[model samples]
Target: MAVHHPATIVPTKLELLQAWVPHQPWLGGADVSTVTRLGSYRFDDPDGEVGMETHLLSTDDGRVLQVPLTYRGAPRVGAEGSLITTMTHTTLGNRWIYDGCHDPVYVTALVRAILTGGRHADLYAATDGGLVLEPATTHVRGSGSWSSADVPALTAPVVSHHGTTTTIHAGVRLTLPRVLVATTPAADASLSGTWPGQETPVVLATVDGSS
Candidate 1:
């Protein structure tokens, strides 16, 4: 389960994206001001220390983009280049945001999910009354069915980016399509998602164990 706080955050997620997204080379020079939030999905961190979420945003040109992010209370060692920004959370205090593709915690969770048929984490909101179950706006599922597959421990994964996709090699190879599309590609195992306006599931990540 993923718990969310009702408290406000300085430099809201959208604001940060507005200042950062446009500069990404994969978008083909798209503008952030015209971007709109489509939906988001979450993967639970077993240790519960890091927050993993993937946001789906739509561009004015009808292109949907995928941005996976991880939130940490402190800086992640050796991830200075991947740091998105630092912001204050009213309830959680200081937070260091990093692109999930470069975070080990996220890579572990993602690989596990894809290899074990994992689904999106349940969402809960912390309120004055208590923890309340909140409906998730986006849904995701992994295609793998190897429930007993041993997930290899990954450390300091080698990451690369090109065009509209990013690839990570850490025992298991993962292909993350930054730009969302409608068709699902062939892969050993994969992750796909669906949102409100986009009910048709679209492939988000693909896994190849050949590595």
Candidate 2:
């Protein structure tokens, strides 16, 4: 389960995205000001050190963009290029934000989810009463089933972005589409999701063994 705090955060997620999205080459000249959050899902870090969340956004031009982010107490080694910005959380203090594609922890979670039939982390609100379960607006599931014998092992990963897709080369290749599309190629392992209006499951990420 993923516990969330109601504390205030400086330079809110929207503000940070507004500043960062306009510069990305994959946006195809879409207006950043019109960007709005459509839905989001989270992946739990077993060690509970990092906050992993993937945001789904929509623009006035009818583009749905996927942006995965990770929040950590300290900067990730060798991921300076992926740093989006730093922010202060009223409860958690300072946070270092990075694009999830370049963060090993996030990559591991994605790979594990794809290989182990994982689902979006369940959400809970940290309240004075207690941890209260919250209904998830976005849903996701992996196509593969857990198999202790077929565990995925991710080593040093090389990440690159091409057009609207990002690729990560490690023990397995992970392909993530920055822009949501209705159709995607079948892969050895894949994660698919459905949002409010889009009941059809769309492939969000895929993984295949290294050749």
Q: For this target, which candidate reaches the highest lDDT against the unseen true structure?
A: 2
Q: How many backbone clashes does candidate 2 have?
A: 0
**How many steric overlaps are in each model, in order?**
0, 0
Given candidate 2, what's the lDDT at residue 37?
90
Put down candidate 2 lDDT per residue, 1-211, tens digits, no spaces: 8999999999999888878887876765666676889899999998999999999999888888999999999988878899999999999999999988888889988988888999999999999999999999899998899774576677877887788888999788999998888877656689999987889899999988872
Local distance difference test, each candidate: 0.86, 0.88
Q: Give the alpha carbon lDDT tens digit for every residue of 1-211 in model 1.
A: 9999988898899887777788877785555557888888999988889999998988888888998889999998878999999989999999999989989889888888888889999999998899999987799998888764576677667788888889998887889999877875646688888898988878999888755
Query: What's the lDDT for residue 187 in model 2?
Result: 64
List the pairs of residues colliding in candidate 1: none
Which stretches of candidate 2 lie above 4 Å from their native place? none
